[model samples]
Target chain A: MAESYRRSRWSNALFVAPYLVVFFALLVFPLFWGMWLSLNKVDLFGGGQFIGLRNYARVLSDPVFHQAVRNTVVFVAVSVPTLVGLGLFLALALNKTTRGSSFLRGLYFSSSILSVTIVTLIWRIVFIPNDGLMALIFNVLGLEPIGFLSTKGWSLFSVGVATVWWCIGLPMMLLLAALQQIPADLYEAAALDNAGKWRVLTRITLPSIKPTIMLVAVIQIVMQFQLFGQALIMTNGGPAGSSRPIVMYIYETAFIRWDVGMGAAASELLFVIILCAAMFQYWISSRKEVA
Target chain B: MADRSAFSPENLTANRTLFWIAAVLAALMLAPVLWILGLSLKNNQDLMHGTDAVFRAPYTLKNYADILVNSQVFGWFLNSLIVATGQTLGVLTLCSLAGYAFARLEFPFRRAIFIIVLFGLAVPEQAVIIARHQMFNWVGLHNTHIALMLPGMSSAFGVFLMTQFFNAIPKEIDEAAMLDNTSQFRIFWKVLLPLTLPAQATLGIFTFLLAWNDYWWPLISATKKEMYTLTIGIASTQTNFAQSEGLGFLSAQAIFASLPVVIVYIFFQRHIVTAVSGGAVK
Candidate 1:
């Protein structure tokens, strides 16, 4: 019996071994390795002198890095509210058992399934100056075409618009699910008390879905903070590097310029921001059970 | 409460208003896609002059024909297929086994290992990507399908989801098999594993979509055009002014590249919705 128990323990270890190997080698080990890489003066070639915190300091001071940080913040700031608010709004509007609601839900969520390349491509044509869709609308309205991808703030805003269109599906779906989870009796009770639609929405609907709202916000923040592909393909982080986010900066630093140490430091900074958002998400999810 | 009755005229008007508003918003959501489709049918010359012509006639299939004739596009599609499918299978196997172990098996340091794996949830890809790229470079694994598929397989989310799923299954089912003197691996293989098919479908679809849509890692690792996945390959094919000079072709490629995911969305809409919402809620 003892021998069989020991053998079973070993067999169980076999079940976990493959995943542990991948988990350690790729996820865990790379984190510490990246930290070490950030501390040294490293590159693609054989150059590794212990540089201490200089890379961090340099990255913190670089104008381009500063711009990337600002741009990333602007993106997260703009898109998170838009995605969360619009998602909740749509969820409320469509939460009813109305005709064609499911089809509309699927229609809204379809863009989220597309790749960033496809999303960006579709938006680029729409945002093109003079002859694109938005420009055509502007022409009909007798307004001048704005250089969405060429101007500075407008460039990043254009990326944000594309991102909202591509990403609104997620928060909408999540919020709609959360809405469905709210017991029907709550609304019935409110109606019995002669509550108005606005009153019921605020007192019952908003409070009921607050946890999901936070979850959506945190998820959007984490995702939007890692703004890489959209900014990369749409504006190419152009108009004098006004729209480049932190991930783009990290990619350019590490891959394009071969500044491994600086890139690692920049990446670490990005991880800190994302980690905070993720932690907030975990916190809300953990508290969700109690709430 | 405005009568608070489903059949009331006030409520009827409100519901109609909401439906109309939703319909308009849905149209706004769909216009870009339809416009792209329209542009894809129009000649590049006609579009270069003005996209307004897309609303008119004289559409052609030449752009799609060009894409179909481009063997490189198919090569990239095949590469994406291999990578996405390989990543999905690997993640399913590794995560299911580990999830089973964490959920049921007795082992030394199991809790510690599980905690470590959970911690991986917070570590963003950007943090490890530089070191990972360099490690792959040192080992000369860059531009390989294995490298493309391996990192994604280290999915903490998969392990977490599968573990929760396994834990939900009552132990009595497996215990009965154990009473028959069946080996533990067989119990997991023949008995418990089959029960987790729904979970597997969810995780598999999520992982497949993620792998298909992944861009950053493949962009760096698969620098060689031959090794590039469809996302990277399609993006690379876009010239500086392809939107103007080759507008129809560009639209065609975007539409083509998105077809697989669109098909998956159409087929697995329920599973995809449940996975997205349930994954977050749980």
Candidate 2:
């Protein structure tokens, strides 16, 4: 009996071991190894010698790294709010259980289903000066077609626009799920008080779903921080590399330039920036809740 | 006053306004996709003429045919299918096992290990991507679909998701199975696993979509042309076509690349939404 009992307990370890092997090797191992690599001058093809903090120092001084960091921040700042805010507003409008609510939800969510390749490709076609969708609209209005992808100033912003369109669905669906969870009685009570729509939204809807809103916002920031393929495919981080995100910079650094240490350091820098954003969000949201 | 409640003039106007708002928003959202479809149907001569020329005459699917005949679109599609399916299956099995163990079994240092997995959740791929690439290359898995499938197969999110689901199953079921002299494996496989289909579906859809739509990791790992997944393949095709194949070629390729996920989304829309929102709330 005792032997069989011991066997079962050990068997439980067997079940988890397969996952842990991969987990340790790919995730935990890489995590620490990357940290170590960040400190040294890593030679991908050969041996590496430790040169503490130099890679981080280089990242701080590199103009392209600075540009990538700035560009990533700009993307997260603009795109995160647009996606989260637009999703929340749309979710509110669509949560009323009207006939079109479900259909409209799917409509808004369709673009999100597309792969990044498809999303970028579609926008690439649309952003073409005289032959794209915007062009069609511009031609109708008898206006000059904007060089959406061609111009240096407009490139990053255009990438953000495409991202916003692709991303709104996830947050919208999340906020909608939270909305569904809100007790209908609260709304009935607000209605009994003859509260207007704005009052109901502020006092009832927003407050009730505040946690979810924060969740959506935090996740949005985290996801947006890792932006790579969009600008890579759409702009190739171009028009003077204005749209180059930090991840793209890291990719080019590590793989293209084969500067593993410098790339790892930049990766660590991006990780810290994302962590700071998440922490900042929590701090602000918690303070707001208390207030 | 009772009669005033149902069809008040104010409510009627608000309803009309809401309808217009929803209609315009829907149009804005769907217009780009429809415009892309229209653009994809236009031939190169039509595309170069102007935006208006597309609507007038000369539709052609020669671009689509040219791509299908000329390039490895189907090969990329098949590769994407293989990796996405393989990764999803591997992740589902591994995560469910680990999740069940954590949720059901009493073990040493389980909490510590689970915390590490949570850290994995917080750590984005960009954080560890360089080392991951190096490690994979060191293991001789570079330029292979296995490399793409391997890193994603052991996801923290998947483990967490499955753990939550396993925790929700009544402990009495496990106890009853134990009382019946069943081993832990049997209890897990027979008693608990069958009950977590909803969680499995959600996680499966989420994983499949993620693996299919993955761009960056695949872009690096699958450097060889034949090994490229749909994303890397289509991205290259888009640029290559920019100079050679024209706007219609790019649009057609975009549509073709989009077809699989779009079909999956239309069918399993609820599952996708639930998985995302569920993961978010946690």
Candidate 3:
């Protein structure tokens, strides 16, 4: 029996070998390398000095880093709630309907499949000044055409709007699935109790889908903090760096500025922030589970 | 108590209003896509002018012709196809093995390792891109397809999904296979993998779309024009073709770039929907 157990153990090792190799090589190795690179003054073509927290100290003093932090905070503060709230609202609306609901759900969720690049490009056109869709709409309303993408104040907001439109689909689909899982009889009971739509949703539906909602919120927060593609493709974090996200700043520092050390330092900072957020999520989720 | 009876005027009005509202919202969701299709067929002059001539604009195949003829668009398309397909296959093989192990194996430090793997899901590729470039350079794999495929082959999301699915499978099946003297690897190959089609399909579609649409890594790593993927190619076109007043052709190129994924989506939307919804559940 012990020999058979040993054989099974060997088999388990063999089964897991391929995955562990790839995982270590691709994910784990680069992560450690990033941590090490963050410490040193590394160059693009090779050769580096061991700076030892100098890069980190420089990042702390940089005004651009501060701006990136502010922008990221603003982005998360505005975008995450909007995305989850809008998604939930749409899911609720669609859940009540019986006719063509499946088709509508598919239509609503389809945009989630489009890449960030395509979404940003399409919206860049839509948000263009003077001759774009927003211009056409304002002209119809007899208002002056707003420079949505080019203006300083409107740039981040415009990007946020486009992001909200693009990202609402997945959360919407997830909420819809969760809503579907709640039994029909619960709603029927709520109706029998003379509860209004609002009450039923608050008392019955909300509590039932609390876990899913929390999961969606956590995922959205993580994703929003990593917002880079839209800023890169659409605005290039322009209009005097008003829309520059932390990730974009990291990319610019490394690639455009050729300051690999500074970029690595910034990446490490971003990594810490993301790690804290993830830990917070884990803590909250586990606490809930235990409760 | 509210009456459950039908045929009430208020109920009828509410139903009709809700239906129309939902229908309008659905149409609004599709408006951007329709607008893109409209722009693709128009001339550069028509596109800039923002005239209602979008529909009445002389429909020409010149844009499509140019994309097909003038640029290295086809080469980029082929590059994206090869990379995406290769990455999909790699992720399937690797993630499934790892996922099955995580689900079924009773190894020492199993939970600890699984937690470490979960941590990977939170590590965005963009964060470590500089280091990834450094490592690739060191290994002499920079600018190669292997550079593209390597990072994608180890997907946290794929492992997460597959593990969730694998965990749902009964353990008796593995034991039954063992009693018949089948190897563990063979059991995974012949028994578990067949049941994993839905999960595999989900990961396959997602990985394909991701690798196909990846811009940053390709933009940085693939300095050569010949090595450009679809996203990089479109971006280069938008930047380089800025002077030619060739919005129509550019839009057409964008359309062409997005077409393969769009067609695949349309054909396999049911599978995609199931997968996405299934993913949400887990």
Best-fitting candidate, scored by DockQ: 1
Residue A291's lDDT within candidate 3 is 57
Against the hidden true structure, what lDDT does model 3 obtain?
0.77
Model 1 misplacement above 4 A: A1-8, B1-15, B278-282
Candidate 2: tens digits of C-alpha lDDT, residues A1-291: 324543435556777899999998888899889999999898668478899999999999999988998998899999999998888877776765566777888888878877888888778877877667887798889999898987988999999988998888889888877777776667656666787777777887788889878878988998898898889888889989899999999999998899999999999988897888777766866775685
Worst 10 residues of 3 chain A by lDDT: A1-10
True contacts kept of each: 0.63, 0.56, 0.36
Interface RMSD of 3: 4.4
User: lDDT winner among the candidates?
Assistant: 1
Model 2 chain B lowest lDDT segment of ten: B5-14
Candidate 2's C-alpha runs over 4 A off are: A1-8, A280-291, B1-16, B240-245, B279-282
Ten residues in a row with the worst lDDT in model 2 chain A?
A1-10
Per-residue alpha-carbon lDDT of model 2 for B44-159, expressed as tens digits?
76667565666766688887787778658889888999999999999999999999998887566778878888777777888878889888888889888789899998679899
lDDT of 1 by residue, A1-291 (tens): 324533436557899999999998999889999999999999889478998999999999999999899888978887899999988878876776655777888899999999999999999988888778999999999999898999977999999989999998889889877877777667666766777877777787788889989988998899899889999998889989999999999999999999999999999988888888898899898999886
Cα RMSD for candidates in order:
2.8, 3.4, 3.3
Give the alpha carbon lDDT tens digit for every residue of A1-291 in model 3. Answer: 223633436558666688888888877888888888888887777678898999999999999889988998999999999989877877776764454765776677777777676777677666767656667778989999888877887889988987887788788888877877776667676666667756666788888879878878987898899888888777778789999999999999998888898899899899888888888778877876775
TM-score of each: 0.95, 0.93, 0.92
Off by over 4 Å in 3: A1-8, A96-99, B1-19, B48-51, B240-244, B273-278
lDDT of 1 by residue, B1-282 (tens): 354554232232235567668779989989999989999998999987888999899989999999888999989999999999999999999999999999988887888888988999888899999989988988999999999999998869999989999999998788777767888789889999999998999989989999999999999999998999999998887658535778888889999999999999999888788777656532
lDDT head-to-head 2 vs 3, winner: 2
Clashing pairs in 3: none
